[model samples]
Target: MAFKFGSFDSICGQGALPVCPLLGTSQGIEPGCYSRNVDLGGTIIFQPGACFIHIIALIMTLIMVLHIRSKYTAVGRKEIALFFYVYAVIELLCLFLDSGIIPTAHVVYPWFTAVHVGFICSIFWILLANGFVGFQFAEDGTPMSLWSLRISAFVVWGVSFFVAIATFNGYASFSYTKPMGLFIVLLVFPIVCVAIYVVSQLILVIRTLDDRWVIGDILFGVGFFTVGAVVLFAFSVTVCDAVEHYIDGLFFFVLCMLLSVMMVYKYWDSITKEDLEFAVGDKGAVWEVKECVVPSSFPPSRLASLPPRLRVFEVVALYLLTRSVSLPPSLSVPCSHLRTPTSRRRTTSLRTEEPEDLSSEEWEETSTTAPNLLEETTEATLPRDRVKATEARAASKGSTTRTHRREVFGTKKERESLLGRIGFSFFDASLPLSFFL
Candidate 1:
């Protein structure tokens, strides 16, 4: 029996490569060996899926990066996420250089050298993303320094530079022997570092779980943690064969895109401590959002300021508690339908661009129903009509009492119209006929 990837292997047949499986099927071995000439080139293209996945991830990355920079102030964790994309682009480019995947992808000796360099950069990025989550976790109450983030990033770049140089010099031949040293540097180091960083960040967030932002940060950390786990599993396992290379990368890129979207949504508003309130009781806890206050002026640091001092239960509850908005016991409109009838259905009062998808009777019924619904809402909200003007009309014409009263009680408190007797507030000329003038 063979390890089948759907009906793909059966259809595609054998592929040309040294990178393909040792024994394609189980029958090859007298006891356990299995060999079948399966077409892996058909299974995995020369460019592989990572380069394409990179394109998708790159687009997502750019949209978020542009949105963050243009709409909001500062970079923070979102900027860190941007590095994930940069790494993707670099990794894909390196693969193209080695495999001649891209159009006119000329494979030079230097390019083969660059494959090792690109691998180092990729590792650095994963570690960087992991470390950023840690930095975000540390941002409770204190203003996280932009300078620190910059410095750390630059340091990673510097280190990546040196590592690339070393790899270029040491591993001259592309097909170097099975290197235990490369394994330690590539697989073990990044995995251990990422694990430590993520776990530490989790611990930090838990310690100061008061801030809802912290909860968001925790989610971000978890996402990266999963990415790191997948990467580590793929790299560390000898039998896995680099997670089938292209397939693993495709999965990884897509996962990052998903995580990036969520992170963008979570941190969109750039919320402060004032924006949230915690309501804890026997029914568990819920985030009581007042007016969600986004900072008009961000601090010098792109980093979000984490809120201080929360119960441990809040942290645990954050994990248990869902991220969805709390719905009313009875929703006015179901989730399936978001747009109100007012937005979708046209009223006779307002002529819409699109024709109504209804018959004459249906249109009439709909138009009528809309007004009645509005009237019901208005009637509930509006105060009872007091006919003061009507009362005055009948009271007196001979006596100036009604007139005097009209002059005295000039305005109604809750009147919709702005027809109240507004006395002249600022008169440029102090004359008797100044108001009239």
Candidate 2:
């Protein structure tokens, strides 16, 4: 179906209108409504560059999905990463449609509309994922942002629904009137909103926080480039009319991959370590805030601060573990608190023990665990001489523990959001990316 440039004349033959290319409409009509690249002898041909870029992105997307599934344990980060994976798949399908691998028939409209919604969902998830990250950056355990988080997504989805209706309507009446105006509107809205959210968060982090956090910020900034790619796509569709150009999807897949991978590395470095880290620096408990719980071994301190939604998650996870739910083998959590005083200890080759270590018995008696509220405290008095000898050491350790606990409970590094973590250093980041292959 040959649409007259800037007009919907349908000059040659408007038979099926089989494909909706992101940039332009497919060429030819009916059984031969081909021309992703060329419609020669009633057969569609695809440009190699466009086709393979999509293929490469699809491959990368799958690799990311597999790695996250096998490695990362944080349910929140995992869900976000999965959304990105699904986003890539949807884009790949759209690429297939644009490449004339899938016929753009009237029958395909319903399915295509669904695919479009999935694409929107990908954006929605990214928006929320970023929102959660931003919230964590500024306020660790505050409950006030709950309404804003929900309302913001609701608004975006609500607008997107109307836009989707308009889009379908526009395509339905494509022959009668060009939906170019509405098309431009739909394309611009989410792209701008997402781009703005990511970039603004990065800027806010950089302005307010220290240099250590810049690594995650840089990743978010890289993710923002996906927005630029969307802008280029808008220009291509509206001005260039490069219907066959799949660079938009290509850019999105790659950029988002960078963002999601960077996030996984920062939040759950344990999974990405051996292959990536030369030395996993223990920056003291107070410095590295606990983001999520590992199902295999929940850190006693980290368990106390489970995000509101995951309050019951720890219970369910324990149930699963007891039932022997198979998990990808990873290093066990430092259950130093769980060990009995008399248990013989062996250290792993990779992990280094903290300095100023005490006997398991001594550590347990001195340590503070989550309160049951019912258990009565039984105090053990040390020998006066022994106490005097170790009084300074115990006091110092207690102070640090309390400080770390306070940091976990809505204090210290409150301003250090995820973006600041991204800007740590390039060499630090390059390690993980090197193992990504």
Candidate 3:
């Protein structure tokens, strides 16, 4: 069929060039090819979709470069560093070709076609590096595994480079030709590397379920990148044409931007507010009252040094006490110890013996018999001692009061203040105070 403007053949067969089946089948291929033809004087001569993809990839390259430059001194793997350097150079070259600054048709420029393919495949290598780096950081904030992946990715890209050179020189081209080389090196290798990296990261995250935010961030970043890569791959294949190509590129760009933002947010959120405030050297005043609250079986001091598991039990007991007047089952003890029958019998016998031993006149004269008079004489003779005793008792009471206040009120208040500053108010302050009382 003769070529038409919007028809697949017409767009792919611009500039009076022979129609290639590979080019013809690729979707979203038309706009880029058509645009390139218009740029090269109304005839399609080069693959526009491929050129556009490279240009976008070059932009991504610049972003990666800037990110690396911003964090150059950050401890990471050497292989990742090399990948960044090589990927940057390749992307720059691809940008030049896509911009049409490097003419491939000239015999003097016989290697330009091979160079273009090599650079195109290198974009995937960079993406793989990025994903691997993310996975490394997510697991332990280290980059050791990224280095290994980078080395493997480079080997894969190297093989594609030789294939690109051979194919462009009109050497034996198999059903697995330039595109296959590009797919294996750029698309397939990177996808596999990222998949492995992401899965490993997820396993680590699941194992360390203590940090939900980290897991969420990893999932967000990897999921976005995976979807974007899939869309880009579809564009690279013939399933998507000109308009779809631009759409895919835009989608990929958005996903990348979202991933970057998520990484930043996750890093900042990981730092607790107390740490942040301490870093700023802010020690604000705390308003609180303390009470003398002790554990049923042990002194409050004993509870402080208990192991984490025991501490958790103590906290639960305290919470239950605060919520209810009845002592928890864990604290319940027999009433016999509180009011012993033996002690009650001893008290009764003493009262009976004391009544028979005392006559009213002798009891009045005897120190033990006239209990009220004995108490009066003792008080009258030791007035100064009483004052000193009162002062000592007051001081001791004050110290005990402060200790109880801290145990009952200070900790909860401090925690509430912290949570409030961080914008979390799920637990009401009154609940803990009631428990302490």
Candidate 4:
């Protein structure tokens, strides 16, 4: 049967109201009515709001294509760029179909059917490309499983497209009728894929402490799409009628436009001025500091090697890794060096040389022995030997004085709290909670 907008109003007549679908056909007239809209090439074409959403989608696809082509040179990124170009082409075609620029039917019926099916396939391709891009950028590295994900999304969309076409042609039937069934499949599949990508992205952000710009962009896009999808799904299921459908379509359109603008702004510099390298370089520096400040990777056995006071600092360092803002370049370099095998061996050796307890006699002996040890070690043999010697001498003097003070007048927890205060202020200034949301 042909669908017409405002059909429900006509059926109700002037003074009468439409019955509620949820309250049963026998129930009194309800205040709201469903709109009658025809599905053309798998898109609802009667609603201007949906048309607007399609236009916004096309703009976003174009921006992504240009951004990737200009800023990224990696082999994997080039492949992603190609996918985006194809996505843009298909989206533009779908927009034309919805706009009636392309005729809905032809003398050869199968030709029309093929065009309709192609439209649905194109939408799926765009979604697949979007998911791939999110996954690629969120990881802050090349996707190792790029080929696998691409192949999987392609297979799913191909199968779903043919199934939708067959249903439209009456060759197949399902419990919910073919068109609705196809809609449900298409809607649910992408939602599932996007959800997985978002969760993976969240984990990557937490673990690596990457910049929020990339994470925030993906979250906003996915969040809007998800809300829009839920509303549309409810409308399609007959839980809500035509008016609800139109309202939801309007909301979706507005959200899509907002998402498009967000994407553009987030990548504007990288896209226009070829500054992705600089942005990535800054992110790398933060990631390096994050790795250094957290010693979670260290075994519990290693903690015993450090002096009691230094052990407390290690604990402080761990806490800072979790909450500190902007790790200094100085700390990052030493932390990286310490993680190396040779550097680790040297640390172990130094710990072995440290006395269990520092007495005045022990301090003098250690201080005299350090100079002699320095002379014995060749320049090549101990690249960091001089620095280590200087630091060790300072630590020895400090520990000896502190120990004497404690023995003479009972010690109190007199450790300076500057690091904690500095960490708090730095974190507050650099990352406000508003940025995360």
Candidate 5:
């Protein structure tokens, strides 16, 4: 069998150069010797080798689409996934067209072939757009970028489809004999898109990426694409004759194209990294929040050893423990008392009281009696005078034992310091504390 390039209707029967199977406007392979035509009832299936490969290619394209979708944070992920989706559709049509599942003699074959050609052209245009996506020409995954890619691809596909349909149906100037428009749309246009895409991606990899190995993927992809094209168009006849029609360029071409597409995915994946901080993944956002640790006597190394939840609690506890206790502003302690440690103890003693057994209501009443207590200490009194007044009050109340204990230990006799208030034995006063602001 031989290959022909003109129109689907003009495809001649088998003699020397068998007419192309895909609408005759595009390049297609004839049935090889190894192609076993199966008869499922009355229908004859042709080109099993090419059909199987097309199926494999379609499966690979779908897998690549899924792979592209998985990289949610990758730059141009949405656009590139769209590219694979289009390619998968193209491969699906190729399966029907190239495999002879949809025979050229069928009326719908021309329409499917035209649409296939259009998709091939459009998918390449989308690839060129993807190259610019890495440069951040527009914010990727945004409506502007996605819509522009979609609309432009649609236009490319529409124009290519028109040319193919016109050529196949012999409408307008696109004759079946000379399909110059179809040639440009199906062949030359894709070459241009591929060339531009490769150049732009090379620039991106060189300028933006640190690892130069990613360039190898691009090179490999280009090489595979070139080889696939050369095999399909230039060496198809040679290979067919050499193998005695057991196999043809179509098989090698599909395999090579699959490898090329895989390489494209690898190249894209290598160049783009996921923006995990911003991009919402399938697992959703996993915010790792930690309380801001202020500088303190506890070194960061030690603090880091504690659980994240406990770090904040320990910091607060340490803050209250280390700070010096002071009188309330309303109490009006004398300046002299604040100046000396001994004077501070004496002044604190005047305000301090024993932690006696009291009901919750009594404690609340005592805590709320701020005005009466303030009035009692309006004027500054000597420490000796205050001690005498306290002792006399205690003697009258018949609590001389409590008053004696207060005089010995000052204000701290019955009061638990802030350190004890936390009720954790982890704190050690002997440990060295360092503070950082």
Candidate 6:
């Protein structure tokens, strides 16, 4: 219906009561030729296309919010997530209100419409604040930033709600025929907020970044928003008639809006780089074992200082690296202390030697030596005489056995430090090393 511009007096057709766009009232716009409503039982559903699109938009907003939450280290993540949350709520209210599920005649229609309108204003306000957040004006996700954003948004919502309710009820200076306050708040305010947000973000991207690609995201978002607005406001009736009422501008509008929101997330994610290397909490663990586990030089006090579970982790780590889990007869020493070239060579020699070759005295000496392997193997340096004896004994075995031992032990480069070996093994293992680390 035609509304008199700033005129309170009744005058011809222009004085007709103005219909709120979301209230499902006739705006004197003619229905398309194919316009029809779905009737199930006694209930009638209106604008099914718009309703379905609203649901899709709501789901997409929720998904975008979840994606924002995943960026644990991204700047302004919390603020962006909050913006999507508000958008999701607005889309939910729009779905019910626009679909006739909550009929226009319902008693709570005006209140729901007020809330929906208020949220629309608040969401744009939040978006503008987010644009400022990119500049680090107040530290995006801090208590001060969040609290100020929330409080200001709430104030905007309260004021918008008051204006909407006042217009609907014709309270104060508001009138259905002349809703200046409602028009300014519902239409003009959102437009201003969006324009300011666009300009602020453009400045942020251009001034702070060397990558110019993000500019395309902002442009695409603006393009979609502009096309959607033109389609919904300027050509809704024409498009409805052209499409035979099967679908109208609202469907395309919601679709474009969803794309715009997705672009917003894309732009934010592109510019905000998360330091994945140092990221902690839900993103991933940042803990790293910088010190290598050198058994020969490892101090007893240091080993004792470690937590019990950490010691077990070191043992498991060594086992994974060597692909061997053999425990010495005495379990008093740490597992790393057992991994010595001398003990491995001695074991190889024992495996190749005949039991009959050792006399009674040699066997007794060997038995006494086996018990002290843990202590002797963990020494900083082996005695020269013991090394010569072991070498002589290894030589007594056939050359074939010595070659096999060399193959088994690998080159000195292959037998790297425990930490280096474990690093390669961790990646190749079936289970992720993150669980242990």
Instruction: Find the candidate with the highest TM-score and give its number.
Output: 6
| TM-score winner, 2 or 6 | 6
User: What is the C-alpha lDDT profile of model 5 across 317-346, one tens digit per residue?
Assistant: 444433433333443222211111122232
lDDT of 3 by residue, 376-429 (tens): 233332424433443454467675544433332234434233222222221232
How well is each residue in 251-344 modelled by candidate 6, as lDDT tens digits?
A: 6777788888888888988988878775656644443222223333223333343344444444456545434434332321233222222222
Which pairs in model 5 have colliding backbones?
2-18, 8-23, 33-245, 296-434, 296-435, 297-433, 297-434
Ranking by lDDT: 6, 5, 4, 3, 2, 1
Give me the displacement of residue 51 in model 2, in angstroms: 2.4
* Off by more than 4 A, model 1: 1-48, 74-85, 91-99, 102-152, 168-175, 178-181, 209-437
Reference-based lDDT, each prediction = 0.36, 0.40, 0.41, 0.41, 0.61, 0.62
TM-scores, in order shown?
A: 0.39, 0.42, 0.39, 0.41, 0.62, 0.64
Error of 1 at 173 (Å): 13
TM-score of candidate 5 on Cα atoms, chains taken together: 0.62
Rate residue 379 of model 3 by lDDT.
Answer: 36
Assess the local accuracy of residue 79 in candidate 3 as a C-alpha lDDT between 0 and 100.
Answer: 39
lDDT at 256 for candidate 6? 86
Which residue pairs of candidate 4 clash?
Answer: 34-242, 35-242
Report the candidate with higher lDDT, 4 versus 6. 6
For each predicted model, how many residue pairs clash, with residues at least 3 apart or on different chains?
A: 10, 16, 11, 2, 7, 1
**What is the TM-score (0 to 1) of candidate 6?**
0.64
Q: Cα deviation in Å at residue 336, candidate 6?
A: 7.3
